[model samples]
Structures are given as structure tokens and as C-alpha cells.
Target: MRPIVVTTMLSLDGVMDSPGGGEHPRAGWTFKEVPFEEAAYEIKGREQEEAGSMLLGRVSHDEFAPVWPTMPEFEQYNAMPKYVVSSTLEGSEWNNTHVLRSLDDVAALKDSDEPGSIIVHGSATLAQGLATAGLVDRYHLLVFPLLLGTGKRLFSTDTPTGGITGLSVLESETYANGVQKLVLDVVR
Candidate 1:
């Protein structure tokens, strides 16, 4: 089975909302609040190199589809298979994009013979659903040092009833800018 890896940016408080500027008042809090360190973002390049495909929720797809295609750093993802889970999205102008209607579709994809990781980025709602359904195999979190008291969070009340535990840390690092990179495997 292909591993579904959830990769996300988070504040110390766990808010996963608007790491990249958006409609939220705390939009762009990641770069705005924390200092930048090139080394802290090295994982992004490695993720692109190792990813077999990409998965996203409708909101994240809408937010990234237009912008990522134009950025040199995101060029590799433009050609990769991108599955967007949405019932309302009719189509996408993004290259190699597919729309999935339900979590069942996601499960089927994970069951496929696809190699490498199915990387999930910036899709908090979809990430939560995947976790609740016990579909995620691993997580890549770049945690900033600050806290956003009010915003969408990654580990919230919606998590699995007992809450997530048994995470095996695969890799971890703290950058000079105080940004932390945590690569954890969700132990089954």
C-alpha cells in the first residue's frame, strides 16, 4: 500500500490555518511571525523529489493550484498527479489534476500499487479526516515557535476519540531560526 504522508506547517499552538497569507487575520503568520532559515525548508525540496503524487482538499487545491504552477520551486508538482477531494469542484485548470468525491476514493488510491509517498500538504480538514479514519501513515510537520490562539488547528477535538499516540519520530531538527522539523511515523 502506498503511504499517505501528511505534511503541514503549524504554529506552536497547533493552528494549521493560513500559513501562506489568506483571508484570515493571522494569514501568513508563518513567515510574518517567524524568522526565515533556508535550511528549515530543505525538506520541501526533498519531498518534491521523493513524492509519487500529491493529495489535497478542495480549499488547499484552490489556494495552491494557481500560484504553485508559476513558482520555480513548485515546478515539479505541476506534472505530478494531484487528487483533490471535493464534491463541488467541477474541474481544474491545474495540470494532471483529478477530483475525488469521498474518503473512500482516498482509501482506494492508497491501496493502489503506486510507489513512494502520497504527500498531503496544507489540507487541515482533509488531514483531520484521514487521521480520524486511520488512513495516515506518517506526518511531516514544520512547527513555528509562536502561537496563534484562534485559528484552524491540526490536532483538535475532532481527532480520534483517545487522541493520537504512539508516534515514532523518524527524524527531527531545530533550525537556527527556531523553526522545528518533525518527521513522525504514525504507529499502528
Candidate 2:
């Protein structure tokens, strides 16, 4: 079975709401605090290159489908297989997109004979669910320096602390922009 990895940009307070300028109250907080650098793009590109498929929740799928397709930088990502977990979504118009009706479907994907990592990006709800289910294998977190006092956090209150124990830090890097990248493996 392939690894199920979750990559997210979060604030110092663990808020993962809007890392890239959105409708959130603390919109653009990430960029406002840390200047964009080549290392950041390099890190993101490396993740995209290593991923065989992307697993997203409805909210993330809707947010990305409209924008990523139009951008030239996301050409490779758009070509990869995308599985969107949603009970309400009937279909997807985006190329290479599939709908997953339940968490069982996600489990099936992980168990599939896929070649590379199944990366989950910007899906806080789905990430929480995966954490609760003890399905997350690794986490790649870009932690920004600022703190957004009120927003949807990466680790919600419902998440049991026991679920995240025994994590082994694989890598820890501090970028030029003050954003810290922490790669952690969940030791089961």
C-alpha cells in the first residue's frame, strides 16, 4: 500500500483556513507575514512531482478546480488523477477527476496498487477525518510565523491527542521567508 500524506500551510496558532488569499477574515495572512521565495516553490514542486494522485475534500476540490486548470504552473498537477471526497457532489467537470462517496473509498485508494504517494492538500475537514481514522501516514506542514487567533485550525478539538503520538520527525527546515517546513512520519 502507498502512503497517504497530508500537506498543509498553517499559521503559528495552527489555523489552516486561507493560506493563499481567500475569503477568510485573516485572508492573505501567510503571504503578508512571509515573503515568497524560490525555496517555497521548489518545495511545492517537489511534492507535486512525487505525488501520483491528489485526494481532496469537496471544499478544496471546488476551490482548486476553477483556478488550477487556468494557471500554467499547475499543468502537471491538473494532469494527475484527482479523487474528490464528497457525498453531495454528483460529478466533476475537471479533467482526470473522480468522486469518492465515502471514507471506505479513500481506504480502497490507499490499498490500490498505485505507484506513488496519495497527497492531500488544503482539506482540513478531510485531514481531520483521516487523522481520526488513523489513516494518515505522513504530514508535510509549512508553518508560517503569524498567528490567526480565530479560524479553522489544522488539528481540531475533536481530534484525539493519542492519534498523533509517536510521530518521528523526518525533516525540519527553516526557509528564507521564515516559514518552517516540517516533515513527520506517523510511527504506528
Q: Measured by C-alpha RMSD in angstroms, how accurate is candidate 2? A: 1.4
Q: Which clashing pairs does model 2 show? A: none
Model 2 Cα lDDT, one tens digit per residue, 85-163:
9999998898999999998899999999988999999988899888887789998998998878987777888667436
Q: Across residues 89-141, which tens digit of lDDT does each residue of candidate 1 receive? A: 99999999999999999999999998778999888889989888888888899
lDDT (C-alpha) at residue 91 in model 2: 85
RMSD of each: 1.4, 1.4
**How well does model 2 score by local distance difference test?**
0.87
lDDT at 76, model 1:
82
Per-residue error at 53 for model 1, in Å? Answer: 0.7
